[model samples]
Target chain A: MRFWQLASFGGFLLLLPLILGLNDYYIFLTTLILLYTVIVMAWYFIGGLAGQLDLGAGAYHGLGAVVTGYLMIYYNVSGWIGLVLGGLAAMGVAFIVGFPSFRFGLKEVWYALASLGLVLILQKIFLLWTDVAGPLERYIPFREFDPLYMRARAKWFYYYITLGLLLITFYLAHRAKRGKLGLYLVSIRDEEEAAEMLGIDTRRYKLVALLTYSFITAVTGGIYASMVGFYHPILFDGWIGIQTATIAIVGGLGHFWGPPLTSVILLSIAEYLRINLGGTIPGLHQVIFGAILITAILFKPAGIGPYLESLIEKVRKR
Target chain B: MDLLIDFAISLARNVVLGIMMGSVYALAAMGLALLFGVANLINFAHGEYVMLAMYMAYFFSVTLVIDPVVSSIINIPLFFLIGLVTYFLFFKRVINAPPLSQIAVTVGVVVLLRNIALVIWQAEPKAPPFTIFSASYEMGPITIPLDKLFATIISITSLILLYLFLERSKFGTAMRAAADDVDAVSMMGIDTGRLFLLTLGISMMLVGLSGSLIMMYQAVTPTSGLLFGLLSWAIVALAGLGSIRGIYLAAVIFGLADALASGMWDPRGREIILYGLFILILWLKPRGLWGRR
Candidate 1:
């Protein structure tokens, strides 16, 4: 993390609390953004840094939400315990899916399809598992703004929780990027053959990246489910899978702050477009979303993150 | 003995239905295989191309009172041109980029094209006017829809034609050679770029044909491409990477599995079985059942 990044983090943290008091809608939107940022950051671990196109985050997210929501609703489990257990459950699934994928040489398109298949499979399971979670919606009981219970009245409570998770992710991501694991993962990502030849346990490191990323994303999913007070099988959706990948890519691969930065800009624009034109024009937002991706790929293949970083570096040199 | 006879009869029905459905899948998978072989690109937008062809067939039938089958025939040349233009404009730019970028570019095409269709046509399911042989045919206890029989016949004929083209034609031989070794074919003075463009064009034309074949039975919708697209993905995976014969066999198997599962349980259960089988195949045999490394 650089001075600018730290400064920005500090600035956002300081400003967010003040902004929360202004309006409920702003708080709700910011809270959603914060949650997505956590997801995008988790996605960056495997997608941007490890260089794997695992589209299975939605699988983990849905798993975490289902597990946590189920436990809290039926077993009366505390949201805190549910959060950890949800993460573990998702991690377990990540191993089941990621083990063969990495152990064998499933790279690029195959990996993507495999991950996507996992999401669909999980969604089907949840949809059909009527004894547990079915096509019907499941809701969590809400309490009066109780942060300890993870049941909050005001949206700001969820905002703070998501912010805390974001900070922890930022710290972990920052450390990994600077440390040895980051180098190993990056080497494996850039060229798996050369990395393996150089004695790097490419499969093991890829598994580690996947497991860690899955755990954090699941925890966030639990938080999201609690905040929304409901869960559905569609929680394991293709849209979120695409959105997370898009954010990571648009943020620019291999940049720590890229996903978060892209999340704020792109998601805000998407939300704005949805609100304004969504009523009149069906599928219009998707058209614009795709257009943005095409423009990004055509013009800035390196991504907005690296572009911003270089710009800052030039300014500093001057 | 009665119970046993009933079960046997049901199984036979499913098997026959599966084969019919599988033939359609094979027809779609052939286009995907051709593109993958010649261009080494999976064309995620292949489904959208199919969707566009269906829409074209629908409008042509609705406005001009042409038969759906004939409209699809007319769509082939236009779809081929669209494929060529899309490649030159979008896919050509990302031919050398990493797989993620390649996937992203195609995904963008999927979103753009699908949404564009939505904007133009709305989300309503549309079909041509009623025609003869739209009802089901009964043979003993087994019943098969007439539209499905026609679709299966058309799809099988197209696959056979594709097989002959690849086996006998000069351009087909060139495409096969390029699939095997791009550089070697280029060294032999073949214009690989034009070959790729031609491959994409033909691939789109085939998908358009497949779309029209199904238009007689299946209602055309903007989002129908997504389901068929994923189904084709599963088919391609099951068929292995570049094996045309394997695609046909795999498509039959997939079609059979879908029919049997839905018949035995429910429609949703069929999806679970199909996707479960897909993941299992990817895990156990990444190269597919018949594909060599």
Candidate 2:
């Protein structure tokens, strides 16, 4: 029965674009929403599961982007290959930074700040490394339709790709949640000192979570770069990391479906507001976004996920 | 021989400039340190407040046709009130909340304040044309702009005044006592809640003063908050919780880095030098250079 529900949800998303006859604009919007959803879902590893509150999603995302974009632009590598390479690059950097950070026991605000600072450092590096990505926007080759290269003019093509990635992400997140890794992470998050006392080798487990999260986030960046057909140092956006964390927290941290659900709903509202009220008031949409976040944190600190799970439990009981 | 001498001169010139700029940075970081030490609140929105104060400075300066520094008379009191209101409305609930929830609330403030600024200012960098000290004078081969000079003087003076207040005043003792032991302080017939209110107020007042001083020469952009925010954190990390003097020294070191980076290296890479230093410090000496505890 649970399997059927999951399959139906997957099937619905697979046919969403076709069923709605969403134009290119809508597909593009949905794709943007899904891309962020993947980032927030990826946050579940280090943030929700490990309780790290890692805010450096932009660092990994940007690394993935620059590597993939640079490989495709300069080396003529297919984006499929670029995407894999991007994920690997992100994982490698995560390990390098994560090893020291976890070893030093950088937790709470210090860890968050360090991660946030990483985004700015990487952005500046790319900006100054003029040969690869300077202050200027580097354009990727735009093809009318090239599936072989993962370049396409149609928006749905990228939408389907993003959707496929999102499904894989869901599966991975599900597997991770139910596994031994998940059990270790729960202990590490709730009681780090206790977990360490229990001989959990907390640092390695945290690094593993960081590496996994970074790899998935980097793939989203690669897809983003190809879909947009351009990349810049600005792709290394710290705001995206902050927003991803916000969405995850608002969706109810630690829940499998919370982040993705909140991501889609909130992003759709943001897009609607951007279209309707953006021209007149400029930041009306974002102001509403901020209000929603604050209210959620204060009133429903458990997040929307717990309520959702309880409802599902009742239905099962019935 | 000439090129080498010229290099030495430019390097010396940058050192002088960095010290002056670092003074103002000390003033900015001081507020954050106080908020951290006293309130125990990790204010992610510290830079946003400074950004908003810059806007306030611009608003007052433009309307009154006065120097931006003069606008502190209004900005300080106004920000103090804003601080009190925020303490009551937002911060009071999160005093004992976990760092995660505190961060969430403050990050919420960042989003709200930034977007509010965007709505009001429309992303354009606002700079009032009024300048009280627009002259520059030469001391040997190094030149110092009078505007920056006055800004530095004002910054150092404010730092001294705040230091004195913390050392000499009755409430200052109470605030310090709260920092050391909030429950014990409250047990001694002191209102720690009011102390936190004042602490937040004073912290915002420092931000107001720094904003006015910064507006002496620089323009206020929406993104300016992010830059200043990270800068304050970097300075605090470098300074630790030892003393105000540490904050000053660290800010100056940061200023020199800023000066050297922009003057000697690419101007765009300054953040790399600064935040790179911040991460390194976090790894090596998370207790900071002057940290006593």
Candidate 3:
């Protein structure tokens, strides 16, 4: 029964684009949902399994966007090539940022502060780096909505691209979940000192997790830049990083499907609120998001993932 | 030779200005350090409380026709109540939770406070209609603004008063005891819970006073809390977790660095230098400048 439920859920998502058709607004929203789901899944590796409360989503995502923007604008590179290079750039940055923090034992609050500071530093750099990226929004040219380059008039091309990214990320996440690296990561997250005492190289495994997470998130950032048709330094916003953190926490940390599911529900509500009441009543959606985050943290720290898992267990017992 | 003399004079001016700004930063850091020492929690929403106090000071001056100086005094108790209420409502529950949970709670508070401020104030930067402190006193080539000077004086006086309170008062001793060991402090027949609340209250009061004092020279915006909040964190981190005197010293260093950066480079350059300093300190000396391992 549980297997069937999972299968049906997957089927529903696979059919979602076809069912929604070419309604640009709904398609755009779905593409955003898929994009964020991929990002949040990447976050789960470092934040969930590794037990590192990293707020450096902006660090990788922003870097990827900037790299992609720079490549496409300056070198006349293809957005598809930018996608791979963008992920690599973000991974490189993650290594640089994560190495020092992990090496020096910056965990929990200290780590969070460092990561947040990293994003701020990156933003300031981009803002001041007038040679490559000035304060102005750099636009990506679209040749009558070229889908191959990701500058499409119709949302379908981006939608499929995001869907592909989501599938690949979800597959990788599943492989990690059932693999040796996943076990090591969870143990390290639960008790790092004990894991180290037990002869696990926590630092190496953490770097691996962080690098993988950064690479995938960077790809999403690259695709996001092309989808949006422009790039700005504000893409590395700390608030967006916090939002990703909220999704990971609320989705049930360490749960493979939790982040994506949480993103779907929460991001949908947020977008709906924004579209409906944004002009009529400003800041209400954010207030709701804040209140929900607080309540979830206080009341449901285990998130919907554990609740669902428990329900499955009860059904199996019956 | 003339170019070098002009550069030296400008550098001197920046150093003086930096010291003045550093006093304000110290005033803010004092509250944060007190909270960390006693509460053992880093309030990311520290700047939101400061923002609230600034708005209150602004309202008092604009609506009730009260002087900001007098209104700031009134803010002490009001903000103390605010702190006490906050403790009971949100903080007390998460006091024993994991560090990440504590952080999430505070981040939630930040989002809520910042957005609420945006809704109420409509995101417009506001300043009180008073120019008394805007006057500058010049000594040859160097000019010091009166508002900054007044702010520095107020901050120093508050710091001295705070020092005396912690040293001489009964509750202050109890608060210090609580910080040393919660179980032992409670075992000594002192109510540790009340002491924690008192510490938090005092911290909030200090933030309140600093916020009001800053309104004379700085404009208060809903988003201004982000920069101030991050700076205070940097100061606390650089100063060490519990050392009050270290906070003051670090704040001065931060202010001087910021002043020099802004004078020599640009405003954006100042932020880069400051955040870089914060990261470097965290890496090199996680125990901070004065914190004992």
Candidate 4:
């Protein structure tokens, strides 16, 4: 691992006790941030490296959540087993959608629209599949702290679980970024036809990217369902997908460390702002957040990742 | 027999209403189609412009005590100016950027404009003033709301005018040529930048018109743009990216599908049906029915 990666991991460990010592409110916010960090990392794989912006992560996340919830409820399956099953299920679905879409040569807006349409379709299916999920929220019954059930009353437990998941996600993202897979993804992102011309099996690589990204996101969804303790159709809402894409873009798409860093900072700020302004201003934080997003796009189009890298370089030089 | 009759009647009514509603969607999507087809830029904030126009009509009707019809008349040029300024200030700069950058820029504008609306109008849904024409009118066994009828007529007329202008007029031809090949069009001594500005202005004007008409049927709020934006996207894609005629057809089909689903099933099912159609159509016909191959 690089020095900064080590430093980031060390800093996370050091900050753990400080975070745990905080009040329940702060712990809740921190836990939420960690959850989004996992998601952002997952998004970075396809969005940042492959340059195919699939605004349909929520569909996979929601499916994973529902699948894990059902397995635990009916089959007495452990959360760990549920997580694996959910990941596999998500991979299966991703292949079904991603194969036709990528193979048919849909890119940019066409691909974005198709991916978005996938979310909408999946949402409808989920809604109609009333046995698994419906309009009403499906709650996972609170069992006494059981790792098998993935049920816990303490926020700290959820926090550690999410942090662990975030670590795994980071490892995968790092591996992909430095390997031949990463180069192929970047080639596809920059130019698909050119990548194909260069003897790269563009379709196979894209399929692999989709499967990997979906599996990670599905695991995050399993954790998210356990954290929230309930699953509803609203989980599959378009806003969920939009916010994920927004967070990924804001963090600097394609950067190894940018998404997680952006998630921690921006989501923390959002949480703080929400606590301060939510009651008094009513949607003011969203307004300000939206403004920040616009400014980030306008000035720092490459995202905060590049800026952070340069700043670290300058500090190292000193 | 009675059940079948009820279903048939319901289906007929929904189909009619769907056609009317679809016309509005088609009108709303025209500007988006033009921008995407011609400028090669997807304006994510296109819905915000529609919101602004709706608010403008609402403000004039309520604050200035002007007639809603007259307010729409006034809104046309006002929205045209706003469209021109927005394009010149923001959109013109990123026209040459990559699709991702273009998307990012427009999304930024969407966020900024939406937040501005929240700050200015608050989150409350505002109902625009309407006349007797806004009420429902019954003919034979069918009841058609006058306001919806008026909206439909206005939308269809506007679309007809747009088609004529694009097909018959020199400016429209220049705009189409610029959209097809900007560099080639410029090489022919035509000012492509001017064409873009004019196109943006006209596009926004059409969106404003649609927004004003929408207010006659439904209330407007800051968040109202969300549903409309998504629906317009569905329409644009279903119509195929650049085909205006396809948009109209797609809008009608979507409207019928939405209305029938709601009328026959639960109200929420309407959303499911509409989105289902969007995905199914794209899967079956990726290029859209009327889109150029």
Top candidate by DockQ: 2
Q: Pick the winner on DockQ between candidates 3 and 4.
A: 3
- List per-model TM-scores for chain B: 0.94, 0.97, 0.95, 0.94
Candidate 4, clashing residue pairs? none
For B250-280, candidate 3 gives per-residue lDDT tens digits of 9999999999999988988788899889888
Could you report the DockQ of all the candidates, in the order they appear? 0.66, 0.83, 0.72, 0.48
In candidate 2, position A9 carries an lDDT of 82
Ranking by DockQ: 2, 3, 1, 4
lDDT of candidates 1 onward, in order: 0.83, 0.89, 0.84, 0.79
For candidate 2, write residues A65-119 as lDDT tens digits: 8888888889889999999999999999889888999998898888999999999
The TM-score obtained by model 4 is 0.91
TM-scores of all candidate predictions against the true structure? 0.94, 0.97, 0.96, 0.91
Superposed model 3: Cα runs more than 4 Å off: A1-7, A311-318, B65-70
Better of 3 and 4 by lDDT: 3
Every model: Cα RMSD to truth = 2.3, 1.5, 1.8, 2.8
Candidate 4: clashing residue pairs, number: 0
**Order of quality (TM-score):** 2, 3, 1, 4
Tens digits of per-residue lDDT, candidate 4, B1-293, equal 99998778777777778888888888778888888777777887777788878888888888878656567788889888998888776888788887877777777676667767776788888887765467788776577888788888988888899989988999898877876788898899988788888888888888888887877777888867755666777787778765567788888887777777877786666766776666566567778777764
Which is the leading candidate under TM-score? Answer: 2
Q: How close is candidate 3 to the true structure, as a TM-score?
A: 0.96
